[model samples]
Target: MDDPTPEVADQEAPSSGIAKAQPEVGPPLVEMVNVWKRFGQGAGETVALAGVDLAIQPGEFVTLIGPSGCGKSTLFNMIAGLTDTDSDGSVVFKNKPQRDGELLGKVSFMPQKDLLFAWRTVLDNATLALEIEGVPRAKARARAEAMFPEFGLAGFEKHYPHQLSGGMRQRVALMRTFLFERELMLLDEPFGALDALTRAMMQRWLLEIWEKHRRTVLFITHDIDEAIFLGDKVVVMTARPGRIKTVETIDLPRPRGAEVITSPEFIEIKRRLLGIVEEESLKSFASAGAS
Candidate 1:
């Protein structure tokens, strides 16, 4: 037997050092199939959604955008089971059809405002969700306390909602939402109430958290720039009696930073999305005034 040549050694190196590739991940964690929803009773009925279909994959961030009265929030309510779908379709979670309260304990929703309890301290407010769900007082306190430093509420834990700034209050609200075991999050304009600078900061902070935790997130925002910046896909809906008009896949690089917003790709996407939104928004406003 003779020693192997350099070429032969090079060929064998990968076999010894490399590992097999992992399998691709599976299907979506949430699916909305041809869902239709309406409000009002009898002849006064108003359709809020018409045959809407959407899907949010595991660990993917999706944003819903549309003109006012296009039923963006109504669609979210259907997914949250706060409202019923009236058509031949369904919302599925983990491949099974979602029932009312099916995700009650597993899903978290952050609304437009901070929604913090005024009387409670920041730490207590953050733990309130767990407390209401029958978790022991000590354990919930422990969990919220552990998250304080990471959440930027370290020394402010004892402060009341009034003592915190708008951004700080929103941070606490987010911490509270994540206090328990929530795999999927639904955020409706979570940062809409913040000022421009604060909102930009929060977006970066939220993205950092999302990268670390990799939760399946469905976020709703009226800001097209925010939608494009944060979403893996931006789902744009038509005006009035909302239905999906377009779903644009965002191919931006990961670990996205503020600088990316200034890139040509980013600017182009922003422009295209703005055009769609403006067109739909004008249509909605015109329709409303005429009626």
Candidate 2:
């Protein structure tokens, strides 16, 4: 497999002292062209996504946010090859069109829940995907054990999910995803269930891990602040029959500290994103009330 790290060109920083990722030279790692998805038929028919066009460059941390029921998970399913797009559109992976289930195993996916097995030890759980790939259990365990310290699970190798705190459980889940070793990772609200402080710490830890690995990431989150904090670009979707409402490039410097959130540029971007998200949320609420 080719290296996923992007080659960024040097550019002058913006007046706000924020630097942005310039356009890369190669084809996008994944591209969705005018994608659409629908369910049922006639009066019962519902459109989940409509004419959605998105492209993810290699080694980019792209965060997606939208109103509830805006088809975020559905979009993720398509990208992960769990489902097919409508006939009228195309989902291109590595510049090739992908059919139903074709992208499976091509991307590592972690949904909202940790989904750790209570019966297995932390090391065993982290090695599950590798073991399923037909790797010898011994070899898989060896590899997983080596990552324990990096994931902050050292000395807890023999512990089960029930024995760990919520944050620790999430780290284990993430370790499993990373160990699977895919070019792209689809993370859907992995930190949503954590408390405020834990979530903040996890966000920082995740960035550190991401910087080390440089895997292409597509993260879905409801928190606008989280999206801006962790993304190279923040993609905002509209209400039901979801489509890309806007894609805001995050210009804040990386290795970002918590103090950066209160920076002028961060606040400015948040204000803009908040307005767009709030407008979509209102529309979603109005539609729900009518239904």
Clash pairs (backbone) in predicted model 1: none
Q: What is candidate 1's local distance difference test score?
A: 0.80
Error of 1 at 217 (Å): 0.6
- Considering only N, C-alpha and C atoms within 3 Å, which residue pairs clash in candidate 2? none
Question: What would the per-residue lDDT of candidate 2 be over residues 1-291, giving only the tens digit for each residue?
Answer: 111122212235222212233345689999987788889877788989877778899999999999999999999999999989988688999989998779989999999999999899999999999999999999999999999999999999999899999999999999999999999999999999999999999999999999999999999999999999999999888898777777789999989989999999999999999998998899999999999
Clashes of 2: 0
Residue range 1-291, candidate 1, lDDT tens digits: 111111111213543211111122577788887676767766787767766667788898999888988998887777776766674667888898876556555578887888888999988899898999998988999999998887888999889999998999999989988776678898999899899999999999999988988988899999988998999988888787676666788999988899989999999999888887887789889988997
The local lDDT score (0 to 100) that residue 151 gets in candidate 2 is: 97
Worst 10 residues of 2 by lDDT: 1-10
lDDT of 1 at 152: 85
Per-candidate TM equals: 0.88, 0.92
User: Which residue segments of model 2 deviate by more than 4 Å?
Assistant: 1-24
Candidate 1 regions with alpha-carbon error over 4 angstroms: 1-25
